[model samples]
Target chain A: MIFKIAWRNIGRNKRRTLLTAASIFFAVFFSCVMTSINRGVFDKMIDDSVTSNVGYIQIHKKGFWDDQVINNAMVYDQQWKQELAAIDKVQTVIPRLQSAAMISFGKITKNVLVTGIDPAAENKLTNISNRVVDGEYLNADDQAVLIGEGLAKKLKATIGDTLILLSQGYRGVNAAQVYPIKGIVSFGVPALSSGMVYMPLAAAQYFYGANNLTTAVVLDVAGKEDVEEVLPPLYAKLDTNNTYEVMAWQEMIPDILNLKQTKDSSNKVVTIILYFIVGFGIFGTILMMTRERQYEFGVLLSIGMKRGQLAASVWIETLLLGLLGAVVGIALAYGLAYYLMVNPIVMQGEMAEAYTKFGMDPVMPASVALDIFWEQALTVLTITTLIALYPAFVIFRLQPVTAMRS
Target chain B: MNIVTVQQAQKTYNPDKIPVHALQGVDLTIEQGEFTALVGPSGSGKTTLLNAIGGLDLLTAGKIIINNQDIATFSDSELIEFRKQNIGFVFQAYNLIPVFTAKENVEFVMLLQGKSEQERDTRVRELLTAVGLADQIDRRPSELSGGQQQRVAVARALASKPQFILADEPTANLDSKSTADLLDIMLELNQKENITFLFSTHDQRVIDRARRVVTLEDGKIISDERVS
Candidate 1:
């Protein structure tokens, strides 16, 4: 009966109901849009740092991460590859040999971190092959090299062009050689272009003069297993005689994880602020509603209504308003998120390259997470309902006789 | 059986530091099945006395007994419930809820009493029919005539079957013919249902028909006459 009365009362003031619901609608809608943008950007950042560059798992020589240019560079590439291949959820394992080297092209020489990769095996594991926009990648017999687009532009080198590389090889010996510039690659990363170079594994091994092997193995796994769960098994399979380490990508990419944490904190910051503003909007509507119905409340009180019930009845009105607004807002936001994900708003020129120039995916993406809708809707609605207590309680304390006398 | 009794009641208001004592230790008693008139000129305390007895206004110092329970000390909620179950009021202005229809206005009292659906509907229909508003049951207060609106108030007053009806110049806003018709209905209802009726008014027509009359002067009852 209380609910019946409340329902009738809401219908009695159509304008008040509309105003309150509109407040809730806009609040939830704005919150949905903002949260979608935040999540979209964060998800893309994570994809660029984690999924594309580093696999969920990576294997390395023991103590190499701590002191990469030191004694831990002591692992055989073939044995480790066979042992890693024995595990399930291990999609592909590609070995790499990295060295700090000085390379010169004619009169211009630059210091670089030279990466040695098995062209065929690395192609299967990473899509580095597909990134080649100029010249062919390393063939079976060719001592070809892949250089970042920026590095090539700086070095003024092109396909089939011979570039000299000079570096400190094993045993501190002077190592120098001539390798053809195989391809120039462009990635989203700004630094990768001018600083990094990829060479054939056999040629690097022959040039370094100290190994038939690699310093670390970068493993790319299937999604069936996560980092923490599969890394332990991969470790047990490794030479635990302190010879090798099976480190998860989480360790290698601490900066990425830290960045994600910061983004999450900021996401929460934005969500709270947006929802709070929405709350104020809804609250204003509820205030107007209660003030307009002050006399109605007085009548209900005089009619022997329990004050608490009266308040509950009013709150239920907001609940209905919230539910209605939430459903509509989420539905509208869903369409928006979908449209944006497909026909992504493209950033033009340097702005697009700037993000990609930094190894960050430039496309903005939005998630259609349902809980986001429920969370935002409930938050705004609950706040409006709580504000309703001022009016509902007013009825309890009101002197019906005096109120009527007015 | 007496449904209400008021003893030594007083209500004072201060306007610009000059105290206007509306009721000063006024005493009165009303019996069931009685049609009583409280007569006095403006500011003579008749309305104040009626307000105090109806539990609509608090007394400065008094004992108000309604249906044998002292209600002067009742809390706001308690007084509201007491009024809902025991007393119905008809104001000179026809105070019907603007949002509700004539039938819903009549159902207001029963709604207060927490009557079940079937009971409230049955009682509301009976009262509206009695007041000759059966055809106008769905019409809101704004749509009704002065006489029709006052009749709706009367229907509402009787809806909860209250023991006493307190009317403060109920016919003051109506035409003479409408006033005569309303008085006739009240007297007929009083005789048939044994529902007590009390009015605070200066209208001699009301006083002439009332079985008992109480006249007030200077905030106190000056005469109590048994006219029947």
Candidate 2:
């Protein structure tokens, strides 16, 4: 019967109840959609960085990444390849020997990271061939280099141009190699296009006069979360005086992690402020509800209705109102998120440049998450329950005698 | 057996200075199945004494025993339980929750006691019909006339089936015609159900119709008489 009474009580001032619910609905809806967009942007950035720039997990030679010396290269024996393949969750691992070298075309010269890789193994790890815009990709045993579009334009070089490369190899030995540019590719980042270069792993190894690999190995994992799981065991198996450090994408790119962390922290600050604002809106309605029924409460007390029962009825009704708003908000936000994901919003001009600069996709695609809905529901419930405290306390302390006089 | 007992009860207001004594150690006993009235002017403290007896207010000193339980010593929770079972009240203002219909207002008392819906609906209908509000059962408090609202209040008070019913100036805000109609219906129910009706009022009409009247003056009972 109290339930019926509460239901009817809520219906008494339909407009007020709806207003309170509207505030809660907007709060939940806005937060869900905004957070989805933010998370989507960050996820895209991570994927781009992991696939194109750095693999999710990288296997480097002991002390090579820290010291950057060619002598620190892990031995390129067949044993390392077979052992790495046997590791669980190992998607693909490409052996590489990277060095800072000067590439010169006629009068033009610029320093670049000359990455030495097996074209086949690199292709299996990443879609390197699809990025070729001007010239053909590497053939087996093809001693060629794929330079970026920006690098080609700067050097006044085109397909089939032979470029001169000079570098100091291990043990302070002077080394140089002449390579024909087989491709001028479209590297995503503007900086990378101007300063990046790739060549076959063995030809560069022969140029450096090293019988084996120099310094670095890159690895691609099955999933982002699997990075930690794969790294620890790989580290344990290859543990040698803690000389080698297995770095995940997150550690390799600290700036990107900082970017995501800063964005989420600001998002939380805005959400908390909105909660308090919506809380006051709901609280206002409840204040009117209790005040309007002051005389009624006294009468109820006089009639031997327990004050606690009255409080419970009011609390249950408010809870229903809050729950309704939360559910509706989540449902509406989900529909919006689905639509945005299908037809992603295209950002133009500075925003597009900003996204590319931060290594993010220019399009905003909303990610669907069940945890988001549950979180909004829980937040709404807690705020609504807290707002009911004042009314319940007032009801509990009411005196029937004074109320009747009033 | 006594249905309500007040033993040397005192109710005082304004604790700091110039305290106005409301109920000055008044002793009273109301027997089972009796219709009684505490009649007085505005400042006679009749309402104060009624409140002290009804467990709505605490006595400055002394005790009140209702239905064999010493309510003056009862805790807040115990008092609520005792009141839920033993007492029903109708206020001077038509104190029906504005949101609920006449039927819902009457059904609320039984709701607190956790009565089933069917039992509550049947009892509510019977009570409404008894108060001559049968046709207006579905109307909200604002939709009803002043007289009809009072009738709903009466039905609500009787819905819980309490041992004693306290009506503090139930017709104070009603027109004379509404007052006459309300008193007539209450008198009929009192006779038919053999339920005790205790009223604290200044209204001559309620005092005139009551079977027994206890007059109070300046915080003390000046006269206790069987008027009818």
Candidate 3:
């Protein structure tokens, strides 16, 4: 009987009920969209930095990350490669010999960070072959180099152009080489686009006079979120001594992680404000309903309805109303997020330039992760539950004689 | 037997500020199965006396005893339970729940009493038939006429078979014909079931039909008359 009364009571003022539900609906919708876009932007940032440049996890010789000199390079061991590959969740292990050198093309000379890679393994980690914009991709034995598009533009170098590279090799030996440009590649991050050069691992080791040496081994995991999971097994399989330093992307790039944390904190504040507004909207409706029905509550009380039962009935009504709004809101948010995920909103003009300057992609997409929908829905319902207590307090304190007179 | 006894009932409004006595040591007794009317002008304590006897308001002093139990000694929840089992009420505006159909309104009290479905259904049908609203059982109060709504209120009041029914200005919102029909139904129920009734009213028609009339003037009972 309480349930029946509660169900019917919701329809007593249809317009008021709809207005309350609509407020909740819009709150959930906007919060879901806002959080989804925020997360999607961060996901893009991580992809640009982690997937394209630094792998989700990296293995370097101790003290090499702090000092990138060629002398700190580790010995290239086939046994280490087999051990890393055997770990669960480790998708690919890419070996690289990296160093800084001065490149001269015609009269233009600029400093560039050169990385030597096994072409096939590098392609598996970063899909670098897909990023080739000009000329052909490099072979594992090619006596050639791939230059970033911005660097090529600055040097006025094109495919088949011979570029002069000079740097100190292992043990401070003079290292100089002339190699034809194999391809031109573009990166979303402006710094990487303007300062990177790639060559075959063997050719780079030969040029640097550091045969059988690699500066870093980048591990591509199944997902960036799985990086921590992959770490334990890799640590257990490799040398227990501190010879190899395992670094997750967050540890490798603390600045970007700090930026993401700040963004998330701000997003949380905005979401709380939205829920606060939603609570007021629902409370307003409840106040009106309780005030208007004061006399009816009196009659119910006088006719032997207990205060707890009456309160429970009203709470059930509010629960139903909140659930109705939240379900519809989640469905609509899911549809919108799914659409945005498939066809991301591309930034243009100044916005695109600003994003590129910050070393990020210019497009914004919504995350369709299932947690966003349920988390927002649960939050709105909790607010509704709290607001529903108002009517219960009124009913418990009601005097039937005065109420009926009113 | 005395079913209701009001002994030195005193109700003073705003005692801390300027005290306006609504019931000043008024006393009365009601026999079982009697149709009684408490009649007075505005602010003469007729409704105050009725409220005091119905346990709807606490008196400033004195005791109201029903079936040999002082209602003043009962707690708030106990009073509510006492009223549910012992007394019924009909308001001037016909306070039927707007969301419920006539049948559900009639069955509400019995539901509170935890009556079985079979018992509640039989009693609801019987009460609605008694009030001449058997055909309008499924209609909501909004769909019913003023007379029909009042009839539903009466049926709801009697649904639990209380010892007495207290009605405050039951005919104030009704037309003459509706009032006459309502009075006729109440008279029939009183005669057929021997159910006690007490009403506070300014309506002459309601006063004329009562077997006993108690008139108050200035918070004190002036006359108690017994008519045919």
Candidate 4:
């Protein structure tokens, strides 16, 4: 009966209840959307950073990551690739022979990071085929190369044009090769586009004076959550006596990891301000709820309702309102987030340029993860419950006769 | 037997600044099954004495004994429990829960007492019938007239089977016809159920109908008279 009264009392002044509930609704809705957007952006950054250049996990010869030279390349065959691919959670293994070389096309010589890869394996790992803007992608036997669009513009070269590559191979052996540009492609990161080239693994290995050797074998995993679970097993399966290093994308890019952390801390400050504003709104409504009904409370108390029972009824009223608002907010937010996830907002203007300069995609998406809804809704509900203490206190301290006269 | 005993009852509001002594060293006893009226002008301490007897307010320097227990010895919470079990209250405004139907208002105290649903329903119907509101069982307070609402209040007060009912100006807001109807129901319950009723009011109709009248002026008892 007390609960019934409380439930009806919430609707006694429809406008007041709606005004109070609207604050809670916006608090949950905006909080969920903001957190989802933040997570989506960071998740995208990690995905682009991993798949665009660095695969999820990279395996290297000891000291190879510190100093990249043809001599430090690991000598492995097709059998090793088969073995690594058979491991659990390893999507595919990509072998690369990486070096820095000077390329010249009609006196426009430039230093670039040269990567030699098996086109099929590279396609499975990075989707290099989808990035091609002009001409065909590399075949396993082609003595052709894929050059960045920015690098192509710099060299004044087009597809099918031959470029001279010069570098010192393994053991300081002088290496020189002339290769036709197979395709031109763009990169989200401008730095990669400015000076990067790709060629067939066998051709680059033969030119560099290294046979059956590669600098790194990269492994692709599902997502950020899978990285830690997948790494320990891969390390355990490797030859313990041999010198090898396994690094996740996070370890390889400390600057990006630091950027995410900075963004998270700043997001916390904004969330705190929002919570502070919402707390006062809830407190004011509850204060009015108790203050305006002092006479009613006294009448109830004088007629034999216990203070504790009255207090509990009032608390339940606020709790019901909070839960209602949170559920509605979550429902509305879920719809918006699902839509945003499917159709991400493409950034434009200077923001797009800034994202490119920082080696990140310029799109903003919202995550529709279930945890986001639960977390945001519970936070608002807790705030509403906490603010209900004011009414409980007022009931506890009520002087029945005095309040009745008031 | 006297169900309530008041000795040297006194009540002071705000002792530190501008103290208004509402009750001053008075003595009164209310017997079971008696219909009594405490009549006085505003600030004459009739309501204060009633509040002290009902355990709604504490006396500055006195003892109110209900059922042989000195109510001053009880804590605030204990006093609330005591009122629930031993005293019922009816306010001038007919303070029925706005959301509850007439039947629910009558059943509320029994629910507080943790009575079984069957017991509460049975008692609610009986009390509302006695107050001539049986047909208006499902009507909320807003649906009922002032007289009907006051009659519901009476039924609610009697629902808990309290030792006595304290009505503070219960008919003050009612018209002459409604006030007469309310007094008739209350008088019938007093005579038929042998229940006690103590009311504080300035209404001459209530005073005329009461079996005992206690009048006060300036926080002191000016006269005590009995009729019929």
Candidate 5:
């Protein structure tokens, strides 16, 4: 009976109910949009910086990350790659032998990081073929190099041009190679696009006087979320006993993670302010509803309805309104977020230029993650529930004769 | 058998500042099955005395004993329970719940009493029929005429089958025909079920139909007359 009464009571003043619901609707919608955009930008940042090149999880010699010398390089073992691949969610294990060297073309000489890779495996990890702008992609038997677009531009070199590489190899042996440039590849990160050189594994190992050696084994997973699940097994399977170090993407990219955290903290402050406004809007409506129904409450009391029952009815009424608003808000937010996700907002003018200069994508997309919807809806409902306590308090303190007189 | 007894009932409004006495040392007793009227002008303590007897308001100083239970000894919650079981009320403005249909209003009290659905349905139909609103049971208060709404109020008041029904100016908003029709229904219910009624009103029509009339003046009862 109380539920029936509460359901009917919400229809008593349609305008008031709509106004209250509108406040909650907008609060949920705006909060969802804000959080979604924030998360979407950070997800893109991780995709560009970490996932595309270094993979989400990496395995290297124990001190290789701290000291990138050839001495710290581990022997490239197929058995280790097979063991890592057996772990769940390990999509691919890419091997790379990298060292810093100076490249000279014509009269210009610039320092570049030379990376030795298996062509097929490296393509799976970074999709290098799709990023090639100038010439043919590298083949396992091809004694050629894929230079970054910025490096190619700086050296005034193109396809069919030979570039000289000079560096100290394993055990201080002089490592020098002259390889024809097969292609020019671009990267979203300015640093990589400006100074990266890719060569086949056999050629690079022979030139560096270190056969069957690799500096890092990059483990590609489906997404950043899979890193945690794949880490424990990888640790147990590999020789982590002071021989190798397993690093997740977050441990590799502290700067980007810190940036996301700072943005998230600000988003929380804004969300708090929005919910505060929503709370007051709902409280005002409840106050008016309670005052208008004071006489009716008195009659119900006089007719033997318990105060607790009456208060429960009023609270249920508020919850019904809140639920209605929240459901609608979620639906609307989902539609908008999904649309934005499919077709992101493209930056224009100065913003686009700035983003390109920084080697980042200029477009902004909203995250369509399901949790964002329910989390915002739950928060608004909680605010409405707390606001509803006002009516309960009034009903409990009401005097039948006095309220009826009013 | 006396259903209610009041001794030295005193109610002073705003006692701390310029107090106005609404009831002063009033004493009265009502018996079972009696159709009684408490008649007075405005501010003459008729409603105040009615409120006191109905346990809607606390007496400043007095003892109102109903069915041998001293009501002043009951807590606020106990008084609500006591009223639910023992007293019914009809107000001047026909205080039917606006959101409810006539049938729902009548069934509301029984629902509070936690009566079974079968019991509530049977009693609600019976009471609405008794009030001459049998055909208007499905209409909400806003849809019904003032007199019909008053009839619904009467049905609601009797839904709990209380010891007595207290009505304060029930006919104040009704026309002559509605007033007469309403009175006829009440008189029939009174004689047929032996149900007791106590009314506070200035309407001469209601006064003429009552078997006993008590008149108040300046917060005190001035006359008690029993008509044949």
Candidate 6:
């Protein structure tokens, strides 16, 4: 019966209730959108960072990550490869034999990071085969090289042209190789595009005199979120002697992780400001609601209704309004978020230039995670509950006789 | 048995600033089954005395004893419980909950008392019938006439089976016929159920029906007389 009264009382003044509820509704909607956008941007950053550079997880020699030299390369054991492939959520692993070298075709010579890769496994990890812009991608048995577009331009070399690579190999062995470029690939990152070379794993290893050795094993998982769950078990399955270190993408790029945290903290400030404005709106409406019903409250009190009970009923009324607003707001926010996710807003002008220059896509999308919706809705509802204390206080200190006379 | 005793009651509004004394050393007693009226001109302390006896307002000095218990000693929550179990009130404006039907308005007090639905239903029906609102039970206050709303208020006041009913200018907004009809219901309840009735009114019709009339002037009782 008290619930009935509280609900019906909400309808007694439709405009007042709607104004209050609308404030809460907008709070939920804006909060959800803000949180969704933040999550989407962060997700995109992580995805680009993982797929373009770090893969989801990486296994490196204990000291190799600190210094990337040919001497620190470990043997690429076929047994370890087959065992890791059998683990669940392990999509594929690509072993990279990387070394710095100076390449020359004719008169121009530039320093480059030459990567030795198994074509099929590298394709699965970085999709490098599809990124080939000119000529064909290299095969496992091919002695040909894949040169980056920027590197090829610097060397004035085209497909089928031979480029001379000169560098010191493992244990300071003088190493040199001349390889015909089979493919030219453009990378999203300018730095990578300008100073990269790819060759068949056996050919590069034989040339560098570091046969069957790889610097890192990059592991691509089924999904980005599964990295943490798959890491400990995968680590246990490999290197019980602790000769290798498994690093997640975030650990590999602590600078990007720090930047994301800074953005998240700023987003929280925005959410708090939005709630602060909406709280005042709700407070004003509830103040008017209580003041307007002073006579009715007095009547109820004088007729044996306890002030505490009356105050409780008023709180229930505010809760009902908050629930209505939150549910509707979440529904509306979900619709907008879903639409944005499907047709992301394309960036233009300066923003597009800035994003593309940094090797990231220029579009802005919204995430449709249920956690974002629920968390935002609960926050707004808590604000509504806090605003309700104003009316509750008014009812608490009410003097029935004075109220009735007024 | 005396249902209410107001001993040397004194009431002043805004005592800290400029005190306006509404009641001064006023003494009154009301027994069960008595249909009494506290009559006075405007601001003559009749309503203040009624409010004091009903435990709705605290007296500046002196004590109000209801059913041999001093209400001044009770805490605010205790007074609320006491009122819920003992006293009922009919306000001047017929302050029925606007959202409730006549039946719901009457049953609400009993609901607060934690009466069972079956008990509340039977009593609500009986009281609304006694107040001649049997046909208007389903109608909300807005849908009913002023007289009908007042009748529902009276039924609501009697729903908890209170020791007495305090009415302050209950007939002020009613028509002549509505006033007479309201008086008839109160008189019937007084005669048949021995329920005490106390009212503060300026209306002569309410004064005429009362068996005992207490007149107040200048915050003091000037006369207390009994009529045959």
Give the top-scoring candidate (DockQ): 6
Q: Say which prediction, candidate 3 or candidate 4, comes out ahead on lDDT.
A: 3
Write one digit per residue (lDDT tens) for candidate 1, span B1-228: 777888888888774598899888888888888899989889898777877787767787878888778996787777777777877878787878776789888886777677898998998888877777789999998899998999999888888888888898998888888888788888878998888999988887778899999999989999999985
Docking class of 1: acceptable
Going through the candidates in order, their DockQ values are 0.29, 0.62, 0.66, 0.74, 0.75, 0.79
Name the weakest run of 10 consecutive residues (lDDT summed) in model 5 chain B. B128-137
Q: What is the lDDT of residue A61 in candidate 4?
A: 85
In angstroms, the error of model 4 at A245 is 3.6
Per-candidate count of clashing residue pairs (backbone under 3 Å): 5, 1, 0, 0, 0, 0
Which pairs of residues have clashing backbones in candidate 6?
none
Docking class of 6: medium
Report the C-alpha lDDT of model 1 over A159-263, residue by residue, as the tens digit: 888998888887776678998888888765757778888988777877787576677777776652455566778767667567766667667678867887887
lDDT of 4 at A141: 94
Instruction: Show model 4 residue runs off by greater than 4 Å.
Output: A62-83, A141-143, A171-173, A209-213, A235-242, A264-267, A323-325, A347-362, B222-226
**A322-360 per-residue lDDT for model 3 (tens digits):** 877888888998899889998989999999999978767
Better of 3 and 6 by lDDT: 3
Q: What C-alpha lDDT, on a 0 to 100 scale, does residue B41 get in candidate 1?
A: 87
Please give the interface root mean square deviation for model 2, in Å. Answer: 1.8
> Which runs of model 5 end up more than 4 angstroms from their true locations?
A66-69, A209-212, A238-241
User: How do all models score by TM-score?
Assistant: 0.79, 0.91, 0.89, 0.90, 0.93, 0.92
Model 6 per-residue lDDT tens digits across residues A26-102: 88888888778778877887887888667988887777888889898888889989877777888888888999999
Q: Cα deviation in Å at residue A136, candidate 3?
A: 2.8
RMSD to true structure for each model, in Å: 5.0, 2.8, 3.1, 3.0, 2.5, 2.7
Tens-digit lDDT string for candidate 2 (B167-191): 8889888999999999888888889
Weakest 10 consecutive residues, lDDT, candidate 4 chain A? A237-246
Candidate 5 docks at the CAPRI level of medium
Clashing pairs in 1: A188-A356, A188-A359, A189-A357, A189-A359, A190-A357
- Indicate whether candidate 4 or candidate 6 has the larger TM-score: 6
